[model samples]
Structure formats: C-alpha cells, structure tokens
Target: MEETKDVRLALYETIMNLVDAGIHAIDEEGRTMIYNQKMRDIERMDSREVLHKKLEDVFRFRSSEESTLLKALKTGEESHLVKQTYFNNKGREITSVNHTYPFYYKEKLMGAVEIAEDITKIERLIRRNHEPHTGYTFHHIIGKSKAVSEVIEFAKRAARTSSYVLIIGETGTGKELFAQSIHYESERSRGPFITQNCAALPDNLIESILFGTKKGAFTGAVDRAGLFEQADGGTLLLDEINALNIHLQAKLLRVLQEKKVKRIGGTQEKPVDVRVIATMNETPYEAIANHRLRKDLYYRLGVVTLLIPPLRDRLEDLPLLTRHFIQKYNTLFQMNVRGITPEVLTFFHSYRWPGNIRELEHIIEAAMNVMLDEDMIELRHLPMQYRQSGHYTPAAEKSPLLKDRLFEYEKQCILEALEANGSNISKAAEQLGLSRQSLQYRMKRLGI
Candidate 1:
C-alpha cells in the first residue's frame, strides 16, 4: 500500500464511529490522501472509491471566493469554523461547518486536514434567522472605505433596537452586508436571520412565503412558517422593497404596524416579534418621483435610515478592495502571486470603476488568470479596451465611463517607448531622450 493508504487507514481507526460528521485530508497538489467513513457516506462514495481525486472534483459547488483547503495548504493558517455545502451522489445536499489546518513534512508543504461538522439542523434555523436582512460573512463584504466604516458603526447601533431600518443606495453597492451584520450584532445573534427578495417572487407567492401556509392552504400547500413567523424574535431583510406590488404591500404594512401574521389557511392571527430591515438600490426621492414606492411604507421602514455610498465616491478604497479579491482568487486558483505591480495599480486608480467595487474585483481576477507569473501586470495584461488610457477612438463616445478614454493616451506612450527600445523600458527611455527617472515618473502618473 502507498503512504497515503497507510495514512487513510490510520485516520479511519482514529475516527471510527465518531458522529462529528466527516474528515478529509488533501496534499499540496490538491489530491485527497485520507478521508473518514462519514465523508464517504455523505459523498455517497465507497471508502476507497476515489483514492487520489482532486478536491475540485469532489466538491463541485465550492464557493467562488476561496476554498478552505486551498487557503490552509498555501498559507499554513488555520481556518476557523468556515461554512460550506456539498452534494452527495444521491443528489442530497448538506451544509457543513468546516475547519482547515495545514499539515507539514520537515517544515515543507505536505498536506492539509479538513473536519466538517454537519449543520443541516442549524442551517434550517439560520435560514429563518437570516431574515431577508441577516448579516454576512466578512468575505462577502468588499470595502474598507472610511465611509463604509461609518455604515458599519451605525448598523451596529440600529441592530440593537427592534425598530425598522431602511438602506438606500445605487445598484451593486453592498447594502446586504449591512443588513446581515446588523442581525448578527443584535440581541438575536443566535436566532435566525431570514431574507426574502421582495422583487424576485411573484405576487401570489410573495404572500405565501412571508406569511406561510396552512397544510392544504393553497395549491400543493404544505404547513409551513413564513419569513415573519420563521424569523420570530429575529430579523428579516426585504430587498428591493419598492418592487413589492400594491396588494402585498398593504399586507406587509399590517405586519409592520400590528406585528402579527395569519397563515393563508389559518383562522387565528399569530403575534410576531421580528425586526424588519428593508433595502432599496435607488434613492427614496428617486423612487418617489418614479411612483415605484409607497411613501407610507417607506416612512415606517425608515425609522433609522442608512445610506451606502457608491464606489465612485470612495476611490481611495480601491487598492484595499483589489487586494482582498486578489487574495481570494489566489487561494481559489492555487496561484502564488506576491502582489500587483505599480503599473497595474495605476491602471486601476485612473479608471472610473463604473460597476464600483464589484467591477474592480472581476477585472483584477480576469487579469490575474490571463497573465502567468505576472509580477507586474502591464497595460497589455488588461482588456484591450482598457489598455488605451482614455484616448479617443471611434468607440470612445460609446464607452461606459470617463476613465476608459483617459488610459488610451498612456497606453500610446508606453507602447511608443517599448517599441523604440525593442520592448526595453531603459532603452525606450533613452530613445525618448528622457532620463529613466522621468520615464518612470510619467508611467506612474499615467498608470501605464
């Protein structure tokens, strides 16, 4: 038997009949070397079905941000109680509480150990507590801006109260993070934090989901708790509250006023004690002007209002936000990138970032993957459209933001220097009759 087989056998003996869920071990190359029997059962695989398969193959639904195993293998840091989900061969999905730690051999990278605790029961409760506005893991939050700091501080305060709270911002801003954080910090931290996307559900389904249904209440009805009752003694986040239709809005207004709900087929009204946090991606004034929102409901939910600033207004936070996403994908892809070069950083700084923090993250992740061992991502590493520093092309007018056109001129200069010097920056500087210091200065200014 191979060394891994021996290790797996040893691990099995150590964990025989332990009801703490499953355990898995992976090597530096992401190959599984050892796994407990419960893991096999949960994955619906035999003990020896897959002795050396890649982790990516087994856990197909891993989060896009980062994987626990990858981070431990690369950084040797222990992941403390991260959460994840997996599906068995029988197509039964399960939630887990994960812990990852690096395993070493002679101080060198060797393998990693994973312990996952089944949280299906806890997840059900969590789903309820995660009322449409429950708190989020730190990973989902994207900014380190001073303005964001203010939002976090105020949210902590609002969470302590049972009064209604409203969040207003442009689309793509991270309002959900605030909503979730509030619930987590509140008195019901251990309770369910449930959420319902008011706009995503149809009118008939909306009422059913929020107020729930009696057994045989409607078509294919099953006795169920709605978001309000399910989130009893906790919180609920109603996203895009303005998108709620008029009829349903009236029912929602009652819940806000009376703090009670009656299931569709139930006779009696049940009192509820659920905090409501509503979010809108548009300003209240704008929604009012468009007649998309009900002013009375808005005022009731606006007892404590929070405004999330757009990414454009907080450009200083760009570098930190970029670094966060880079670290995330680095672990995800098993890439060991030290850092982004000044050239790449410059390109990001000058750009308008129309999609805000979200767009910046996507761009960085894309550029990193396209270029290998790229210590300094140059203009060439960027999308062709962004390589030209804001210069006017036939397509300039149709571009999305002001920053795109500005980079065009910088791209031209960098290209001219590289070409004249046979792609050598020093030689290019000499050809341009510029001291290398002057050339470097220009590059920094232009973000080339």
Candidate 2:
C-alpha cells in the first residue's frame, strides 16, 4: 500500500513540477492541461480545475478540429517536435512550438505529453532579422560570428521601434550597411532615404547640406531638399556624426528634441519626422571629450547603440566574407576571380585586416582584375604587405613548443567551435571534446 501511495505521490509531484516549466499536456481526447505560470495567468484556472477538467473544454483545445497528437498516435512514431498555432477559449491567438511524444504504461500506449514553447518573441525577432529582398537588405548583413550577429540581432530589435540608433565602429566595419538596412526594414521603408556625412562637408557646407536653404541659402545653393526635408518620412543616416563641429552638434540636438529643422538663411523651421541613425568611427564619449560633438546630443542618439566588430576579431568568417566581396566586386568591376586558395585563406586568417571589409573588398577587387576568371588566388596575389618571407618558416613550425602549439590549436578549435555555437562556451566545449576547464586554461594561456 505504501509503495502504491508513493508512486501516486510521484505522479502528482511530476504534474506539479511540470506546471512550472510553461508546459501543456494534451491527452488522446484532445484535452488541455496547462501547467506553467503563463497559462495560469492566461486561463485564470486553478491547478485542481485544470487537472480535473477535460483539457479541451477548460483550455479550449477540446473542440479543436486539428489534433497533432492524434496523428502521432496513429503513426506510432517514436517522438516528434511540431510547431503549430492554436486559439484558446478566450479567442486569443497563440503561437507555439510543441515537443511531443507518446506516453506508455507497461509498453501499452497510454496517451502523450506535449511540451509547448511560445514563440511570439522568436517570430518577431526572426521577422526583424530577415529582410525580404531582391538584394542585400538590413537582414542580409549575415555573419557566422557572435559579435557581428549579435549586433545584427540587436539591429532587428531596434528597427521594430522608433528610437534613435548610434552605430559605433572603426572605418570599413559596415556601419552604413546597418544604417541602410534599418531604414529599409522599418515602417518607413517606402519613404525617402537621405544620407549626409558630417565629416565630409565643411562647417559652412555642413549646415547647408543638413538643413537645405532657399535658392540663396548659400553661395551655390539652389532651392533644395535638405537631408532632414528629404528624410521627413523615412531615415537620415548621419554618417561620421562625430566629425561635426560642436556648433553643429548643438544645432542637430535642437532638431532632435524639437523634431524640426531650419534651412540655413531661411526663417521657417520645417516640421519633420525622421528616424536618425548616427554612425561614428569611435565612441561618442571620446568625441565629446575632444569637443567634436555635444554630450547631450550623443546621449539622445545613443538610445540604441550597436558596436560593429572589425574583421580581425571574426576571422572565422574571412573565407565566407571573401567570397561575398568577390561576388560583389566581381559584378561591380567586371572581374573573373573565381575564389581564394586555402593557403591564401590561412594567410588571410593570420593577417590583421586593419581596413576591415573595405580592405578585403579592395584586395579582392585588385587581385580579380589582374587574375584569370578561373584562377585561384594564391599568396602572391594578396597584397605585398600581407606576404610572408621564408625566414620564419622553420621558426613558425618549431618556435611554439608542442604544449604551446597544442594550446594554439586548442584555442583555434575552441574559437571555431564557439563561433559555431554562437559564443555558447558549454556547447563549444562539448563540441571540442574537452571539458570546459581544459578549454578555459588553453584559451587563457593563448590569450584568446
């Protein structure tokens, strides 16, 4: 009797614990049993009522026409993870993916247990990250690297809102790509996209360009649409925003706060609604310290900040990025560079890409124009600065001792694995066939 009672208590405890995991169970009869905190609030049903009532009637799945588990039982499949949407009794739409499998008693089919995970956030996130495009949309900024992908991921989230975005990175880190992509992905995609390089224009011309003037706003000014006026309903990319003079920063800040801009030498302040995306080669703080920009304006624009990584940090994507740049310039410059050799990739991986993507793009474009369409780019085709002499060959092979070499190899392997895992260390270590500690020690020793 005690043993039977203990088993019964175990089953009850399992149900109670499962409720904490936001899981739902449906039996062969299409009954709903929600046990998570979210369900409790959504359904407003007590645990006893949930467990005692027919799941379909209480949770609103009982009368459903399509039942996933019914098919699973019919097929006698071992298990399945299915994604589907359903509506509860309150007529609210719910999107969820369910991991389901059959439950058995003494090898007999008892029913099934379904663990459903809500994916509203995930779906919204995916829509934001991917752009439906004929070309490189904001979502096309793909990277297998965490540093790059995380920024892209954040950009998607930030795009769903109207907050000002400040993108900071070194030159050639693709800040403008993000800026453009953000505009194209947002609700204002159909609006005019205007871009102004605060650094490219002189102080005198800067104001004129940002805030258009009447026919005589400046010496060469025609009645024109300023960046703000052009970007009224869309986005204005303030590229190299830190290059603006402090005076310009103050003027820009007032426009940001007031949502209006005045033309140079013009009296009227044009009411404009533009999403501003500002990019800088360095931190806004540093820009402020140097008196290059205003601190208040910096804070106002940095509500959503993204830092783009230089190519050196994400060397794993070098081969892929090389091909992408090759394809791009392949069409642009009408070159026939097929691909880069593994030897070239090795050198590409080792060499620091100071100019980042621009340097890579430039190198590929230079090599492509000079090489055959079918020619595989070798070490010689790379920039002369990237070439290595024979003097270090012997030292390269032997200087780093076996342990150190092992450390180096281990670090590379760990990094690759980590990159593959989206910077999830536990997953990376599992993939490296090493304990997390072993991976950590080697990483620290290698300064990786």
Candidate 3:
C-alpha cells in the first residue's frame, strides 16, 4: 500500500510538470503544496524557493485580495482567465492569465490550484505598438465571376461610408480583406486600424481587452486602452463576432448606439470615433435564432452587410483563381510552372471546397512543391488525401470520347476569353477570332 501511494504521487507530479502552463497549488493555510517546473520558469524561481513556503512570502501582491489563488481559497469560488501581475521572491515582475479553482473534501476546504499562461511579452508588445499595417486592399482580391464581381462592387460602396458593417462568410472567405478595403477607402484611412478575434480570449479577459481596464477594475489590472480606444478615429475589425457572449454583445451595442465607451470599473464615458466592422462564419439569422448573437446588435451592425460567396458557389472563377495562385507560387518557388491540367481542374470543381479559396491556394502550393520538371499541375501532383478522397475520377473512369474532349477544350477557351474581356461579347468574339454572333451561338450550345 505504501509503494502504490508513492507511485501515484510520482505520476501526479510528472503529469503536472508536463503541462505547458504554470501550475501552482497552495493548502488552506496558504503554504505551497505544488509548484511545477513551468511555474518555476514563468516566475524565475527555483522549487526550493516556492515549495512548502507561504504564498505571501513567495510573491508580493498589492493586497492579499489581489492574489487569485488566495482569493479562491478564501471565497471557495473558481475564477478563469484572470489577468494578474505580481513580483516574485527575486523582485522580478511577472504577468500571467490565470484560472484558479478551490478544492474541498467532505465539505471542508483543502487548497487552491492555479494554471497560469504567461502573457508578459504580449502585453509589452501591445503597449509598445498598435497592430502592423493592414497590407490588403480591394485590388488584392482576385476573382472575375459575376457573383464575386457583384460583391466587390457592393463592398466598394460600403467602403465609402463610416457606418458599421457586418460581413458574413465561411472560414477562409477573406472577410478581413473586405474589412480592410473599407477602412482604407473611408476618410479614416490615415487613422489606426485594430483587429481582435472575439473567440481568442476568455469571457473575463475579453471584456477587459475590448473595453479597456481601469486600475481598480479587477485584481492586478492597470489603466489601459482596449482595442476600441486603440482604434479611435479609425476602424476595429472584430472577427467571429458571434463568439462574444450575449452580455458582452449588449455592452457592445450600447457602445455603438452611444458612440462612447466606458472602461471597466470606470464611470466616465469616453467618446470614440471608431467604426466597427464585424465578421461571422455563420448566417446572422441562424445565429440569432440559436441565441449565439443578440438580435438588437445584429440589426445595429448589419447596416451594410456583405455576404461573400463560397468557393463552390463561384466555381466559374476557379480557372482564373488557379492561374493567379500559380503565378504567386511561381514567383515564390522561382519556378516557371504554367497551369493545371483539365483533369485536375475538373476534380477541383467537383470537390466541395469547405476551406474555400485558402484551401485552393494551399493545394496549388503543395502541388507545386511535389512537381518534378512538369510544367503543368496534373492529377498525380495533387495531395495524396485529395486523390484518395473518393472525389477524384481516374482517367480510365472518365469519358474518353475525342469529340467530348474537343467540346470541353473549346468551351474552356471561350469561358477564359469572356472572363478576360469582362464578359463583353464583342471583345470576347474578337479575342476568340470569331464573329460576335458565332461566339453567342457557341455559348448558347455550351450552356454557358
């Protein structure tokens, strides 16, 4: 029985030390019971300095209440993603986001445990600088299909206004690109532009990060501007806006309606001239129905909503998009790759591109890496998963008629010419070395 108990303790310690985040635990009397290696690295303290020592002796806080672990122990409550900054025994300052919980046995308090993720570097960088320039513009968007072209035109119009905009699309649909284009096009172009993923941080920390924090807002919080204040006089792109809990959404709506922000635990409201552009991966109506998004906030933000079409919905642009990615990889790889084979293009069109344009670009890049002296991307060059996914048709299984091949070739040529000419029938006809009427006839026969 003694040997089994020893082995269990060893296993628990091993697992605790292996965790990426710092793990620290203290008994009801506040003496340290567990201090894992990660905690040692985070606090720059040796185990000898921490283990069995009173929590107050190992770290200095403004008050006993400022220590989350101690607070949990005292209150018998759990706290998550609480930002805390303190000084270790070596007098070195450390900052971390922590989740602390109290443990009990037989209705009697035992101890408190804390898991801390070090964010000192991130906090310092954010304080030193606003986000880097948003390098994308409307010109960077590549597509010629009617669906994409219409959306781009609408986005250009939205770019001219300062009204809040909601962009809805699936993942990898370039919602940020549209958001940046609007910011650069508006009069606020010279001002700051900030982005925050709504789902990136926990509920407790996200509120402070978005609305700024006052010194006395919570334990260890310093007076700091949030993303909204940082983006004053410019734009704030909130990605995955639906990820925000409904309470925060209500706060956000209040901010939008009043054009002012109140810092956490602060009474004075600061007027901010910031335009918000929010994006969501799901439909707003569905999100509202499911209570993931507040209806009032949706109506407030959807003043000029833009729904970006998925890749599968606009497959007509596949060839043009593929060629663009080919040129991009060519410059990147310093190779003279031309284009993809018809069989590969057909396979790409048939497959449902769940990852959208990003997936297409990645596939092209992967195919180019595996190419060996082949100028064109063929079926053999595609990723193994794609080829074996049961969506690809082997050459032997496809129709092998010479007439059918000619028909597809001719149709593709006309489609490319029309795309190049912006669907101008006369220009496309001239480019195709045919009369306007003949091109129209072919288009009709080809069901284009």
The residue ranges of model 3 lying beyond 4 angstroms of the native Cα positions read 1-35, 40-117, 121-129, 392-448
TM-score of each prediction? 0.57, 0.55, 0.66
Model 3 Cα RMSD, Å?
Answer: 14.5
> Which digits, one per residue and each the tens of the lDDT, describe model 1 over residues 7-62?
99777678654645678889989898877777776566775555698777655564
lDDT of 3 by residue, 174-244 (tens): 89999988898888899988888898878888898889988878756678888889999999999999999
Please report how far candidate 1 places residue 19 from its true position, in Å: 48
- Model 2 lDDT, residue 244, Cα: 89
lDDT-based ranking: 3, 1, 2
Worst 10 residues of 2 by lDDT: 391-400
CA lDDT of each prediction against the hidden true structure: 0.73, 0.69, 0.85
By TM-score, the candidates rank as: 3, 1, 2
> What are the RMSDs of all candidates, in order?
23.6, 28.5, 14.5
Cα deviation at 334, candidate 1, in Å, is 1.3
The parts of candidate 1 lying over 4 Å away from their true place are 1-144, 384-448
Residue 70 lDDT in candidate 3 = 93
